[model samples]
Target: MYASFFGLSQDPFSIAPDPRYLFMSERHREALAHLLYGLGGGGGFVLLTGEIGTGKTTVCRCFLEQIPADCNVAYIFNPKLTVGELLQSVCDEFGIPHGHNGPGEETAKDCIDPLNAFLLRTHAAGQHNVLIIDEAQNLSADVLEQLRLLTNLETNERKLLQIILIGQPELRTLLARPELEQLAQRVIARFHLDALSLAETEHYIAHRLAIGGRHGALPFDRAALQLVHRMTHGVPRRINLLCGRALLGAYATGQSVVDRKIVAKAGTEVFGDLPAARSAGHPKAVAAGLGLVAGVALLAGLGWAMGVKLPWTGASPTAASSAAGPHIAAARPAASQASAALAATATAAATDHFADLFTTLPRAEDAAWRALAADWKATPDAAADPCEALPAQGLQCFRSTRTSLALIRQLDRPGLLTLTDAQGRPAYALLRGLDARNATLLVNGQPRAVPLATLALYWRGEYATLWRTPPLDDRLKGEKARAAATAQWVSQQLATLPGVATPASGAAAGDSPRERIYRFQLAQGLVPDGQAGPITLMLLNRATGVAEPQLQK
Candidate 1:
């Protein structure tokens, strides 16, 4: 009902893992790095543990994006199976067909033979195999031992198959048992994923909003974000639930701007029970008093305008007709215009809304593109062959290498960067470079000094960079400058497309068009108030062809 009122293409705070809405926090990056390390390490077990709702699955999904084609990966999500069932499941995952026998020993041997043979073949081809077990805490000791046995099929150089155990914190406790000591000892690299910090929480919200087509500050006020952080403790799942509810609340009440008041109201409605001090008084009495005065004034005005006199006994038909005359005619045109405008608006909004929905970025799949771009930009010296330099920069540079890369750079500290490839190996080490006050990177044989502003932008998830070492004047002179100018011209060309219709909401009886617009703004991830501010204007301009007139410009 409130969606059209807020102008949102879809619900922004949905709890479902919409790849488009995935916000990668620093902690998440670290977790992914550790997983990549384990996968790339090529032997032994890699363990990942985290509290519930910390986005462990998301990290795993992100890791899956960079896995090499040569490397066979089996992701076993169900851990409740017995040893025989587990072996059978693994076989199924690897597409190794085997009949279900009567005995456990036969089942194990049947599955193991094909798996070992596959591993041997993969090893001969210089490829690795990985098995990712999610919710691994539930795996019984027997099942885990069966998994350990699969690692026994390794060659003298390194294990043919790698096992990754992902589970809640309880998995650590389970592994701590003396009986499981052998399995625990085999874990070469382990990382515990944690929730985001308060600052990261704020960034997470903004990141999701931006991905959802928001170009400016969204419906969430700073205080509201703080409250959400406090309540959710930076857990992505919890934050999503709370934010989603808050947006719904803001939309329902025709509130475009989601301030603390709206958030508080949403919190109470969703979570229940505000403190006595906060819940102080009701506004119903004041509203009733205002309504009474307005009603009396309306009646008096009608009586005078229609020259109708109300008798002490009853209202005469003649008097009633005189009073209703202007109202009936006034209502007809107003109602018709309102209906026509609403239909037009809804039809327009629905078209643009669907476009936004379909155009969303797929989470994890784009990791390669992002990684390749970053690697290319960072390695100017390797630029002699941009294609070749691409992979070294953290991308799959060549099809021949059979390598995949995933790299994450920290914004707060430029020197703190981690790059990992398909086998989960660290391809580049730049931990020290980010610490320097003025850092220089060689990309495609071109040396460029990195500016603080450029670093800041990258940290904020912006793709491009502004080079500091070689002055801008030197690089952009003549043809380069003309190319840059032409790029701007292309942007103008793209901007000329037809405007998209804004999303609409089911309006309340008393709602004005501006009120509906405000709701639409909130839904679209803009501040909820009905006014079209700069942020809303930008989104509108981007979605639609109509350029909002800039008063300042």
Candidate 2:
């Protein structure tokens, strides 16, 4: 309904992951860079981990789009399989023949020999092979060990086979285990993706709107954008869902412009809890009475004047002038004053109405803020620390340049958490509640959970917020200890491996795919420049021991 009114051609807010609508926030860009780096590195392992709905899969798809033509990639979306099943899946993915009748060991050899031979042939021919396992947290320890063995098929310089593990936080935890130390050591590069910031969230909304054909100012306003960010916590998927619903609500109401009122109504329906409507008072009653009077007078004048004919030319010029003069003069000031007074009254009433509404509505108690202030009052030096008395659970707190406050969970689970300015009443509430299981947080209408390891890895990053009152330096040290322990285990395991040979010095130094490509070029005596054509990647893979990926026919 709003489309025609606003002169728009289509719905601007949509939740679908349209490539055209992909907005590369800073974190998303970094995640994409890490993925591309891993793919281009050509050997060892690359890991990508993040929270659910942080656009990990989207970043992977974007990386896939940029891969070199000669690069063969086998993407495994589902990794929940036994060790034997995984090998068979890899064989199936590569179109390697597997006979029905054979001993397990014999069958394994048949698969491995052909795969190894193929890798050598591909290396000689100059091609890059990559295996990407999404939801890798599901892979069992045995399956992971089997994957480590696949990297064993290599020449003197590097191993033949590159593996990319993409999953939620659990995947990182799995790798961190002492048993999987070798696999962890093999991770040449790893990156944990994060949710977008408030600024990025606004950009994401606009980007999606533009992609959806919103050429001009659209329904969402700045306040709405802030509400979207606060409620969604800068999660793209949740933002999409809320925005989509708000747009639909605006359309349903035949609203040409989407304001806070429309947004609030949409939010209440989508999430819950409608902001209290302002109570009408004497001023509004008086205005209504005046409006009623004006209507009656206008209608009465029209009714009395109907069918009363007067000849314009026959009337005396002085009489006509006199008659029109009084009417025009009388109507001017009365009409102007009535219009001005009515507008002034309406404005005042509206202001009062909203002010009263905000004052009455439930708000996130500023207990944390009060506590910080009290501490400062008691001892100015101690005010620097804000988390002093904050509760542990369901309390999301952040410290920025301007404000430090705890975000209490008004509605836990998978739903929007709306926050309005202290002065502004809620104009919209478009949150959806979801249920979660062990590894998944249900979003919108779907269940998605990242691996526990992925969450653990992400929690180690600078952006991860901690609820406890541990010193920042101490937390940082703990994170370093965990990472070091994991890394050491991996190194020892890879070193003791029976067949695999360690990479030469300067193997995993590059920060990006282009950098890795440059390294590859240098190793092969090609152009030192970072441009990775098919030949460069192929040579790089051979040097690094990454097997050539082949498609199953």
Highest-TM-score candidate: 1
Name the candidate that leads on lDDT. 1
RMSD each, Å = 21.7, 21.8
Judge candidate 2 at residue 52 and give its lDDT: 79
lDDT against the true structure, per candidate, is 0.54, 0.52
lDDT of 2 by residue, 339-394 (tens): 43454355346445434433333343232233323322322223334344333221
Task: State the TM-score for model 2.
Answer: 0.51
lDDT by residue (1-553, candidate 1, tens digit) is: 2333344556666778777766666566566656665655547789899989899988888789877688789889999998888888888898877764674456567888888887888789877788999999999998988887787887886788889999999999999999888888788767788888876787677656545544323556566777777767788887777677666544332234455554554555455544521432244432332333234335644654687542211222223223445442232244433443454355346434423322232233233333334532454343244444443333222121211011112211112122322244332212223322223433333333443222222233222211111112334559768556534433443334322122223222453435444433433433244554433444444444442211110
> Ten residues in a row with the worst lDDT in model 1?
398-407
Regions of candidate 1 where Cα sits further than 4 Å from its true position: 100-106, 268-553
TM-score of each: 0.53, 0.51
